[model samples]
Target chain A: MLSSPGGNPHHPSTVAELGEFGLIRELTSRLDTTPSVHLGPGDDAAVVAAPDRRVVATTDILLEGRHFRRDWSTAYDVGRKAAAQNLADVAAMGAVPTALLLGLVVPAELPVNWPTELMDGIRDEARVAAAAVVGGDVTRGDVITVAITALGDLRDKAAVTRSGARAGDVVAVTGWLGWSAAGHAVLSRGFRSPRAFVEAHRRPEPPYHAGPAAAGLGATAMTDVSDGLIADLGHIAVASRVRIDVRSRQLDVPLQMSDIGQAVGVDPLQWVLTGGEDHAIVATFPRDRKLPARWRVIGEVLPPTGTPQVTVDGAPWDRAGGWDHFGPDQD
Target chain B: MLSSPGGNPHHPSTVAELGEFGLIRELTSRLDTTPSVHLGPGDDAAVVAAPDRRVVATTDILLEGRHFRRDWSTAYDVGRKAAAQNLADVAAMGAVPTALLLGLVVPAELPVNWPTELMDGIRDEARVAAAAVVGGDVTRGDVITVAITALGDLRDKAAVTRSGARAGDVVAVTGWLGWSAAGHAVLSRGFRSPRAFVEAHRRPEPPYHAGPAAAGLGATAMTDVSDGLIADLGHIAVASRVRIDVRSRQLDVPLQMSDIGQAVGVDPLQWVLTGGEDHAIVATFPRDRKLPARWRVIGEVLPPTGTPQVTVDGAPWDRAGGWDHFGPDQD
Candidate 1:
């Protein structure tokens, strides 16, 4: 952890002591500029050159306690999750994320090292997708809120949107499913074992390259599974006005973690269906198209039966609940 | 104010009652898409075509009570102010704003009409710059927080960064200075008169076009006056490694509102120097260049004296305080 400019970690400078510009300089110094970032931090606005002229943009705001608990996740984990989620949205659009603009609001008492460590996490995660933190703003607020805006380059290929799915399209997904939900359950139950499950909830690793790869494979539609398999695909269904049917048998959920599932006393299928924050990609491709090795067929799309809908195993899902930000807090 | 789908204004639906997707649809319906937006809301990500290949981007987060208060400003006013500040950043870069992505976090019990009214303000103001709200997200939080990311097109001209100023360059400004600060003072003092000043505090109209115009006129460096004049210019001085001297006599503050200033018992010049949120364009240009009609010379740049600094009238100004988010909250 970096101490204050005074070089004393015991009495680290608060945001008030460092002031806005001073804190900004300290936080920005850790970031290394990339070639794609024509102009990095210190400018009023960042200049990111997208030779393709068209850019894919996405923004997500993560709040403390609501998105991640300080006790459950480290500052690095929060930062990495925030970057991964937004970059995944760009990836879902079949674009390569090139730049990110971060907006952070934290209380005055927040440790200066928290933000620096958070930025390190952001830079590290962005590197996975060949992206960099180009610009950002920091302000004082009551709680910590990270608002990230990620920009991507499609490289001339048309962006894959949820509206492109059609009848006879095959629904496929890349990256793990239900792991975050399972992790949350394990952590909530205070089961320290099954470290992998707990880590999934801490830092989700979305398949960044698989999105563009799926787009190249002629994907009809794509979206990241941030809000559960059924709910996210429901967005694609509604956007494309198609009926999607997920094959229960084909889903690659970690049912092997039976010990954790038993300890929590919850059905693994429930987590697989309604779990959120997995950061995976669920997309639809033409039935006849040969999918790449990363994708696994899990469902099939059908013509809209008067209205768009999603079904599991040719039956309407009885439990349709997913992550609702405004819903009652379960924990 | 728009009621929910039920069309009963007496018992309007709350955000929690409406859920995330439903509330997003309601907020997005009010937005109109611009030609530059290849795809709008309801997608994994928004696609905006710059055509210029290079894009300028900026993000800002505004927290309730800190940035704006519901009792002081209407929902419409808050939304417009949030959009203005971010778009001004793009304009300060000498780019034409093309798209905006808004991320909003509000309490569950907040009225559904509040967000709709806010969206209306955003759309109405964005039209001033020929920009569009291409995409956004809404989540639940304890307070009303708005995060806006704006994108702009340079149209092939190089971005006007703060680092380009040189000695012998003249510093000029467009748009009003210290009006918002005066308005804030008026409102804080509980004086309802001087409606113009109060409105200025509520809604700032940035000189959006003057930015590109100044760039066309070969302005060396530029930034928006979201921060106070001295503080913002301090940024340019440091970035350009030059000395900036402000001529207070050349400033055109609303001296006619001296009665309000006296009533508040604060120097109007203080507001002119340190007041923020005017959204004005302050730029440095060659002294010999024929500036456009909108540009007004207020000072001149000087060689750096081993350290970047700003002076007023050949001497360092005694008053250097400006708005600091983490500093004391002065009314």
Candidate 2:
């Protein structure tokens, strides 16, 4: 049911020929909308309902090859990852994700189903987050890229931020760490993994409720472990102007795929210390507050010791460090 | 300061070699943050302050080649477009734009300056919108793609939406239309145009405040015209369950680039009728309300005809239809 140049084509030519304006026109032509939209498509901005007065938001983008190999992860995986990351942000804000809008660009030669699959992934993730895929824009590009924005409902709780951590706060984690990193190590080395580790690398199941739970429990500060534990914890440390010290003795708990580390002769502690992409919930609580289940107290926040840093047993745990989009060394 | 595989080693290898988890770790390891962040990177989600309790939000994405030409538009242009679209979305929502989060994916071969330029564009746009670029993520991919999320402040007004149109409401527009479409025509046909039309095609200037103005005026339903007027109006009609009728006679305003239309023998009416991307604000208002200075009453909302559609002089205006991402035909 595809039309080419000869027949009345259903879709326009490459967005290049349409140019940005024409492409936007062709794409948005038939969208039926309402007053709840306040502003629909064109304008310096759009307005929407924020009855609670505060909006919860987050964003994420997925790239081809690095995030998903065309041969390995389907467009659906890309879409799911894109949406999940943003939804996780909303959850991190101690909000319930309510809506999402996506931006997508792909090569013209790519199969049309590719985008549809991606949308399916987006829809699937939205369902998990209890959010709706409200709207989006699409265009042609050299490679596939998916950008997602997630809006969440805060339910009026005070937002938990990183700066609130005070001395004597306990640091805890709600999900596994380093599984994704270890999984990547196995994948790159061409080694196989048990289902759990591979799945960790593919679709991270974030503890969405932990953010609000921590907020409700009066968490002084909170964050997701998208980066390695040490690195991410360092963020909390720097933001709170505090020093964090983790005790490795507290980390030998049962894990979903701990054996994967053994298979590779890799130290599980290293994975937990430096692995990222697990999308787990980490937060600081006053010493007296009870933590939610699965959240293990692994460290404590102290007044900054001249320099803000995260360490293991009072010493900086040396590792390759964390991710940076444009590091000084990045080309 | 570039890292290279050989030679002076400018940047490093492609992201695939570093792997997804590793890259993320490296990217996030060194970011400095503030206390308001309640939650920093690495968690189920990040928590930021929304002291006012009400929040505004919008999202948009840009693809390589489709929205921009690597040969023509710089990465900065791509970033600008991305930020502009989302900021426009926020304005459409009748909110004051505030903060932005970006997501980017590109081939490792991309120059580092490309992303820097993109950030410059984002920062510049944020400055124009009085917003801040707070956080973002980057990954390696085959093509460059940018996704931007914009957050806004409602400043205490109820969100204006598209579904509020009622019978006897006046239909009005706040920005120019068809210029971008006309500009696209000229660019596609390889015809040089007056600089205005070309510029309109390259970078659209959406009327930022028309959204909040409509909200202030108690406009019932609203939407930005990313799609053509008729198509986007159709959205309001469907959502509001009302029929919208526009009088073309009312739309015969002076077009700065009408010469371009005459030069190409293309009906300027076609551009006005179906062209998109001139992100104007269109809203339906009570007949008694005073119209804003920039807005022109173009039509009226009425009881739905069996078929929901826009009409000119009681008949459907035949023209090239608006854009559809997955429509069966292609031009």
Query: Best by DockQ, which number?
Result: 1
Candidate 1 wrongly placed segments (more than 4 Å): A1-13, A306-308, A320-331, B1-7, B10-13, B306-308, B320-331
**Candidate 1, lDDT over the whole model:** 0.85
The residue-by-residue lDDT of candidate 2 on A1-331, one tens digit each, is 3223223455544444445555444334423333234444543344444454556666677666545677655667766767777787777667777667777776766554566566677777777776666566676666666777777766778777667889999999887687777667666667656656766776777887777787888889887887678878887887788999999988753364456555655556777877777778788999999876688999999888875388898887755444322122101
Candidate 2 chain A minimal-lDDT segment of 10 residues: A322-331
- Candidate 1 local lDDT, A38-122, one digit each (tens): 9988788999989889989989888898877889888888889999999999999999999999999988987677787788889
Report how far residue A105 has shifted in candidate 2, in Å.
3.5
